[model samples]
Target: MADSSSNSLFIKPIYIAFVIAFAFLISSPIGSYAFTAQNVIDSPLLTKKIGTNRTIKVDINGNGEFKSIQAAVDSVPEGNSQWMIIHVRKGIYREKVHIPSSKPYIFLRGNGKGRTSIVWSQSSSDNVESATFKVEAQHFIAFGISFKNEAPTGVAYTSQNQSVAAFVAADKAAFYHCGFYSTHNTLFDYKGRHYYDSCYIQGSIDFIFGRGKSVFHNCEMFVIDDKRLTIRGSITAQNRKSANENSGFVFIKGKVYGVGSTYLGRAKGAHSRVVFAKTYLSITVVPAGWTNWSYVGSTENLYHAEYDCRGPGSESKSRAPWAKQLTKEEVAPLMDVSFIDGTDWLPAWL
Candidate 1:
């Protein structure tokens, strides 16, 4: 009886060691069950402070060394800072801002939505090849501000082909309670992953165009034109590059209104895809919801789907043959937190 008890005790220690070793293996990066708990715990804290706290408020109207937004951004130390907040006062600042990768995790907060505006007029087809506000900084956030591309509307077929107001080339960026105003290609999601919530974006002719993986929640997309105009233009032109890139544009719980006649969206690239889920579409959306952008061969690869969408434009029978009506089960994985949940390193509601 004593021999049996000793043997059991010896085996219990070995079993415990084995369990611990297995757990360590499972938690490693190569393990299939690798967890991000440590990452979440180790993420840099984001708050409103400078140097130590990471928030640097910039009141353009206040008495400070920096007057323009660009000057304030240039003043901040690069890479060493994590989260920097620029509190812009109520004023119309006509300037082009560029945020480089070296200045990541910068949050631009304005006094009020309509009160602070960044106004500029530039077109992609024009002599200029860059956007009015170009962002290459990851973990960037912009709220309570307006990015206006002041190009005249309805001047279609001109050399000023693609005029973009704000171009985001940053990963894990978010825009809340902001407005993007432009005539064509308003919010350019160049090549990155982003989230936009409760924002107003207006444009015509593929205004919301990009090759980025992005999600827009509870946003308003206005298609502008006069009463006599027909074929206003598509709202989005998602030009995703690769199949493995998770490259697609998602519009959830959004309202689409058109002052003139136009289709909702079109797949501009071969592998481009878009999903309109739980949205309200106005009669401005064309009968055939998805357009090919004059590309006949790309119809098979592009995946344009809709789920639980309502309004005068949500007529599936008249939709394009290429478009799809996704099942509830199919969209379940897409709605998970991980897809849109970036490091969660930024402040909440930013």
Candidate 2:
């Protein structure tokens, strides 16, 4: 009995120390750059390779090739095939920037998300027209920049009052270490095969919407309640009309939290697909997990689901009946970069 008591005393301190360390880890909030060096995907800042040496500078102080971001993009030829770097200097550019479909392979680089920002204020019935920064070109890449639409909080659930921070409507587009800020419909990921790495997206309702087949890796989603609407808001409203369309939003290893309760996603189509895998959900996420509120279509076709998610809001006992509990084999493809065919064209990925 004396020997057993001595062994217990020796192990107690070690167990207590491990518990304290684990508590610290769970309490720590994700920083501006969520992932460590190993987890980052194709980070240009770390890779130091922008595909080509053809560099253009955009400085607001009239010191570079152009004063506006649009001007620098305009300088690129319509049939641009090779990678060209447009280094935007540290400043808040207050204008609407567009990358037309004709101009491709343009890499928009910034000092950092905190230092470089593109801001505009416009609310319209059209989501694309109200965007502060719109990208319509394929093979586009942006890093360390902030895109924002400063339109005041509009009445929720209204199309005419939609404010979009960024509109991505082209294929093979990627953003890294960037920030998107708006009140409603923040990121219109309309149609594309896109990748977002370590980005911060903030909005209230239907913030990340559209039919884009995209992968969000280590991205942080901050939700703000729309006081105008009595009903709870949703983080995503994916519009995958059919399973054959190959359109969905897959979020991996990110954190979603903020003020007011909201669903992980709401059904926007009969086959609307949205998956959250290995993500952290705070109390901000409602117990229902997903909703089909305005969508009167059959919930049987909806693919709203969660896999390996944690936190207070991830409890599945009260999850919606339609919400799927996927097995490892079922979720393997969605959790991989191959889901978007990133290994073929992307410079690097996990």
Candidate 3:
């Protein structure tokens, strides 16, 4: 009705602006991040039918009490001792979560492992900060969750000191039916009395390391292969300071398999001790198991042992001289849950 040429110019500019905006929406990093953090389909593990009654909810999609996990954690009162149950909804939460040492008795329950995933791109060079989920508090329990580190597990991975999926530096912490995914230093058990049950841990080099006194039961310690790795990968790098340190790592009734020719462990600390008792090892394990970090003949101080383990890798005749094949009597002390003194705080264990 107005001048036809004027109307054509107005419509043309508006159409062009809309097209440019749509293209930018698809190409921007914020768009990608939002897509990655979007809510997931309800996982079977996250069903409300499950017995998760006494807990607060964290839904990243704004349908729950909190949108972020860190906010839910911060809501807890300081120095509170009662069990704080935090039920996380299903989503790919792109966050670096940290449970500080001051907080304790925190129970983090995820809907399901395949549903709720916390992912971070931090490298091990960040040390404790490298963990996608850092648990510094004691008396903690996590069920049906996944912590993943998205990094290239190169054969020559010197770029980072040690990237960890979950860095746990607390006493009396327990993980059940959880999944840890990474390449190197996947589970940093940093000086704690902890228990892992029915968890899946995968890594390549020194995957499970630290100075913690932890026991792994019914767990899968998987060693993935790196084609670039000419030198074989190792599973553990325990750092127990001395015999009197009351620090050791024991894996009982567990599965050690995957794509690797790995040593059982390395002596990172002077009196590092590890025991694989009544477990299954695949042929991927090296025969001369257990190596030293630096000093030769350091196996004297290293207490690496295996007892009645099955599979092709468990045959111990060719094992390292420093690593012993323990008898039942010797394995008795390490086999019990009391090895980590879990009776005090391990829920459903006592």
Query: Which candidate achieves the best lDDT against the true structure?
Result: 2
List RMSD in Å for every model shown.
14.3, 7.0, 14.8
TM-scores vs. true structure, each candidate: 0.80, 0.88, 0.82
lDDT of each: 0.75, 0.89, 0.82
* Candidate 2 lDDT over residue span 1-350, tens digit each: 36988999999999999999777765666432333445664445423655477889999999899999998999999889888889999999999999999999988989889999999999988898899999999999998899999999886546557999999998999898899999889999999899998899999989999999999998999999887877678999999998799999999998999998899999998899999999999999999999998988679999998999999999999999999978999999899789999887666556
Model 1 lDDT per residue over 48-106, tens place: 32234444555567655556889878877888355677767778888898888888867
**Best TM-score goes to which candidate?**
2
Candidate 2, residue 28: how far the Cα is off, in Å: 12
How much is 29 displaced in model 3, in angstroms?
Answer: 52
Worst 10-residue lDDT window for candidate 1 reads 37-46
Q: Per-residue alpha-carbon lDDT of model 3 for 52-152, expressed as tens digits?
A: 44577999999999989999999988885767788898999999888898888788889777888999876755558788999888878888899999876
lDDT of 3: 0.82
